[model samples]
Target: MKTSFVSNLAIQSAMRLTIQQTQAELLKRSQEQTTGIHYDLGLTLGATTSRSLNLQRELDRMSAMKSTNAVVTQRLSASQGALETMQKAAEKVRDTLVTYKGNDGVDAMKILKTEVNGALQIFTSAANTSFNGEFLFSGINTDVKPLAEYNSVPPSAAKAAFDTALTNYMSANSLTDMSQFTPAQMQDFISNTLEPMFTGPGWDANWSDASSQNMTSRISASEVIESSTNANTKSFRMFALASVISSELMDKNVNSQVRNTISNAAFGYVEQAIAGLNGERSSLGISESRVKKATTSLEAQQKLLNTHILDINGIDQIETATRVNTLKTQLDTSYALTSRLQQMSLLNYL
Candidate 1:
């Protein structure tokens, strides 16, 4: 067997190239190695990783939705609390007025009158309940002060009754699905709630500033209230508080007769408000439960996704080390063979 200079050089070059290529490939594989190039290993891990990425995106959306819902829920609960407090106050006034049966009924009326004024103040304050700078009872009028400083001109009766009742209703019944109040709910509030109050006894020309600030804050309701079946309804909910008014405590404080009127109206109205609040609270409870369930569901999906990612992108240290060792052996063997081949010449073989 004879080898010339060109052939010898060629043999050495070929061996060096083979070793370098193999080493490079081994290193690349090592960096991103996983199982299943071997038939024994199934694609579960890879599939899991792929699934994980998709699940992660969904979870992100869920997390964001849940956060917003939390804000709404807190405001709602606070509004409900305020309504409950007003209801208690109204009940007290009712008790006091009813007790003043005969001649002392005038006294009863007097006490009732004072009580009614106090209760009205409390109720109005509740109407202005706020959360995160937004009024909970302002019917989305984020900037509108819920209760204008006790006004005398517009005869506070209409505004007071309607505003309290409507806000209480919105606070309780406001669907966590904000979508229920869009394009229609705002208009409904204006026409049904605001217009009625404005046109009624509370229509004072001076409170126009108060009237101008309704339905002020909203993005797409559907953006928050999305659902698989359909979006939330846009109908305005009427609470009992709006329907009943104690004109006794109109623009200014009143006497015993007015107290009796307010006492009679406050109880029925507050009872109605309570019922509405409970209904809305029940709905929110359901949503909270669903959100919790979704969180668990997403967490489950995350596990599968992680497994898939491991299969696709994560390295299998055991298998990688094994394969790399094998390639290293082959490379060493080729190097040795090339060295021998390069050193050989015709004279040496002879």
Candidate 2:
């Protein structure tokens, strides 16, 4: 038999190393037990770690899209509310015009002008509405205000342009007095000059800073939708025309025939505005529905991906807990043995 001498230092060093390793394993198993997931994914999953990483990345992407969809839904809802407000304002103006069409009374004209001005204010305010620090009616120009106030101090460019157009039309036709403002002359001016102003580049130059292109948002990975409308729409232009005609020309010192013509034109424009607004609202409703469906799809995909990720990286919590408890017992025994070894000195015998 060969007898080998082993020093206490070597035995203590070995025990210390064993304790360190057991402590590390215990910590890992404890964490796995607590989290119900593998503590070290790369180590446990090995070559398949890339699969877990990809699934987690996709899950994160879906979460981001869901957050964006929440914001889109909010913006669309706010825009719909604003449109409804504008529609109501336009409807009020239309109803008032219809109610008191032929009445050239001072009070009726005053009421008509007041209502028209009110509607213009409401429409302008609604068109300039902002959500999440972006203008709802600015189209692609989200940071810019869409519509200038027509009744602003010193008058807006739109108001100034209207005055200039009226002045030029009066000057060109050599109309001396308000009585000379015939229905034929008014119709010609409205058709040839005013209509073109609202429909052409003049509107962009003077009235609206909004873009013709609307704001679009991605509701899903493959789906996109226009999330905003602009004040440059024909509906808004018609509303403005109806308001301008009713406010500027309604209370003028003209005959009933000219007044009726102005009333009829304004009413027609208001009707068009209402219908166009309804169409806009309907379009937005469709987008809202699509967003909802996309959200549902994303949730289902997220759930499926989570299941896949769990299958790849999930730990058996019951087994992990048992291992953790076993490690704790081993670590305690190691600690006790280490303490005993520390106390093992030849001085006691001496």
Each model's total of backbone clashes: 7, 0
Candidate 2, 1-350: lDDT as tens digits: 99998888999999999999998888888888777789999888899999889999999999999999999999999999999999999999999999889999989999989988998999899999999899999989999999989888988898999999999889999987778999999888877888898889999998999988999999899999998888988899999989998999999999999999999999999999999999999999999999999999999999999988888899987788789888989989999998998898999899
CA RMSD per model (angstroms): 13.4, 1.6
Local accuracy of candidate 1 as per-residue lDDT tens digits, 167-249? 66568666343234443444454456554554443433322223322322111223332111100111011222322343232
Model 2: residues >4 Å from true position, as ranges? 1-6, 347-350
As a whole number from 0 to 100, the lDDT of residue 142 in candidate 2 is 91
Q: What is the lDDT of residue 159 in candidate 2?
A: 90
- Backbone clash pairs for candidate 2 read none
**lDDT values of the candidates?**
0.49, 0.92
